[model samples]
Target: MENTRVLWLYIILLCHYHWFFEEIDGLVNLALKKPAIQSSTFLNLTASLATDGLIGTRSTKNECSHTGVYHRNPNPWWEVDLGGVHTINRVSVLNRAYFAERLRDINITVISQDKTVTTECAFYQGSVAAAAWATVTCHPGTSGRFVRIQIYNEAYRDVLTLCEVVVEGLSPCDAFYFRKHPGQRLNSQLVEEIQSNKPMDCGKACFLTTMCFAYNYNSDTSACQLLKIGDPCDTTVSDPGWDFYSNCLN
Candidate 1:
């Protein structure tokens, strides 16, 4: 009976771990955590309130400020540079145009030195707004050295304005940026000092706090990260924060 109990416990723990990892791709909410992904060369990137002019609005007045470019053909598409090697987990994209058609497909793939694989991360089977936000969950697979996102439907009626694109699972260190300041405000909670004797405190805090979405535990500096979760507006991942802290603080 003890052995059976242990097996059951293991299964439960595994499920719980997967459950905690969510794949939400909509307007962006506290529930979804920002991915830690970087390209091997160019590095993953983003746009901002100042750069785009506003949040939650289709800014036709201005184009994407990041390396992302707007195209006249097949609507519009922006290619993000996911630096380094990684296995993709989840993806989210926004274009916000309906007349462009209901939409069709969302594809996530990777290209390496010798081989290329296309793993269907997420998909929508019809027409969608030119400014529509689409999110896809890719199958959890092995290591992918290079990653790319391709969305398709109607051809170039309008430029596919990509508002946000994100993928989590495995991306190298170059694709992300983690800026840590213990005294700063993340959403609302002020990071006190690095809490010692309780390293997993971040994970524990996530379980207790409703506003809290994700967290990082700095074992060396004894620091904890409490992020202000938002809808893809300012997506931040706390775990990668801990990775940096590991080397920096120690």
Candidate 2:
């Protein structure tokens, strides 16, 4: 009876909102955000736009034939640049409905600008049915500016296809902090102040408030002060022991 009740509660939660789960630092973090890839700015991994419609936006298409298909003699790949480095948490890939079987044994690699590569799945053998979406949670601390889908068609060399690709992660615009300026405070209004252990904790306080766009934190004093301006650094003066952070999104 207890198990049945808990299951019903879970079902209710699932019906309300779409949820993506990821394990971060040994803790399961719920991802309620959407994909971060910019469809219009995406570039073909190799092919020209005329030959291949491998635009990242098409990956969002529900049907099969709308996907981007890549065909070449050797290894064919597609990637989307997120414009900036991000703390990537999850990657969802939708297989083409028509010949989903051609995508077997593909590789998904995420690379940062610093040349750091985090391979989400190597030689992934897709056994899922056609038009199915597969989601993979990246390792903790996984981050990159570019997400690449490399398909080495060694079998029949038919073609590599992708219906859609969604990258879920903490973008730089989502959260960020700047270094402390010695002896300087900004003209940005202070909204609130609270005790915080780390810069991230202070950032969370700012993120929770709609009016807060920036914050100042003192690591030694554990003081966190949320600011009202979008960019605190613009108005800040030299201040020691106080680090400034702001949401680049604003």
Candidate topping TM-score? 2
Residue 225 of model 1 has an lDDT of 61
lDDT of 2 by residue, 55-149 (tens): 33233342222223333345556566666677777766666555566766667777777756565633366554576777777777776677776
**For each candidate, what TM-score against the reference?**
0.41, 0.45
Weakest lDDT window of 10 consecutive positions for candidate 2: 21-30
Q: Report the C-alpha displacement of residue 59, candidate 2, in angstroms.
A: 10
- Displacement of residue 231 (Cα, Å) in model 1 is 43
111-137, model 1: which lDDT tens digit per residue? Answer: 553445544445555544666556666
Q: What lDDT does each candidate get? A: 0.41, 0.55
Q: What's the residue-level lDDT of 29 in candidate 1?
A: 26
Error of 2 at 23 (Å): 17
lDDT of 2: 0.55
Off by over 4 Å in 2: 1-72, 114-123, 174-250
